[model samples]
Target chain A: QQQVKQSPQSLIVQKGGISIINCAYENTAFDYFPWYQQFPGKGPALLIAIRPDVSEKKEGRFTISFNKSAKQFSLHIMDSQPGDSATYFCAARGAFGNEKLTFGTGTRLTIIP
Target chain B: DAGITQSPRHKVTETGTPVTLRCHQTENHRYMYWYRQDPGHGLRLIHYSYGVKDTDKGEVSDGYSVSRSKTEDFLLTLESATSSQTSVYFCAISRTSGGQETQYFGPGTRLLVL
Candidate 1:
């Protein structure tokens, strides 16, 4: 079973626009939700993350809106830039010390200048 | 940039051959993981280690075995490699703290089995 599901296998956004990617989870046991950005031929890096306790988190132009009850969360990139174009993934972990991470299929985001 | 490194960045092998992939970390993180990434399917965990010699199988453990004799290194071995195992393998590490499940991934190893 896929514990987490992500929508829009690919996305296109105009520069300076807001690009949004959504993800949903089926496991209520998951408490840590994180987003990762991966470029071609490179490893994924942590973009942002949120916990069940927070409704939203913002760091500069990146934001994570988390809805615990709905078991859904999203990543919003404000003022999107071509540099932000890459494959984004959402992941969930049960809790502390959970060695396994349930990852969404992935979303390839493209920013057109 | 989690101080994680994977060796044999690219390899081509034949079916029924034995292959091993190695992951080494410099951060001394307590947790290490191995996953395979396919075209349509997302990354699937094959095995993980929490400490030296402490390992467990993940969702896709078939045809794969892992060993962590030292905290800094984790090895994934394919007893008999198959074409079905052709994919990119990634290694990740995370710290053990309060909801601190942020994982740092290493550059993947691309394997092609004929």
Candidate 2:
């Protein structure tokens, strides 16, 4: 069974436009939500993360809006650039576990000029 | 890659053969993990090691095994390769300190089974 579900397996957006990717997890025990960005032939890298304590967190043009009550979180990229075009994955983790992470199926985001 | 390196960035082998992938880390992080990434399935943890000779299975531990004899090296072996095992494998290291946790991944190793 997939614990974390992501939508829009693929996405395309105009340069400088806003890009949003959404994900929802079933396990309420999840306390940490993180987004990872992966380039072709590379491993996923940590982009940004948010704890359940915060409703939103922003870093540069990237933002994560989290709704703990809804068990959902979304990533918003303002002024999406071609460099930001890559596979994005959302993950959740429980604090009590062995620090294992449950990742989403991934969303491929493309920013066209 | 946060000072992590995975050997054999790419490999091609036939089914029924044994295969091994190696992950080496420069930092002596106690936590090391092996995960496989497949389309429509995302990344799934296969196994992880908390210290030398101390390891545990993950959700997808079937058909795979791990060994960590030193702080810097973790090895994942497939007793007999299968086509279903054709996927990109990643090794990650984690650090838990000061009430915070950070995980970093290696470039990845692509394996193919015929």
Reference contacts preserved by each model:
0.68, 0.74
Candidate 1's residue-wise lDDT over B1-114, tens digit each?
Answer: 878999999999999999999999998988899999986677899999989999999999999999999999999999999999999999999864344757889999999999
* Global lDDT of model 1: 0.91
Q: Comparing only chain A of model 2 with the true chain A, what is the TM-score? A: 0.97
lDDT of 2 by residue, A1-113 (tens): 99999988999999999999999999999988889999999999999988899999999999999998899999999999999999999999997534899999999999999
> Considering only the true interface residues, what is the Cα RMSD of candidate 2 after superposition?
1.8
Kindly report which residue stretches of model 2 are placed more than 4 angstroms away from their true locations once superposed. Answer: A96-98, B96-99
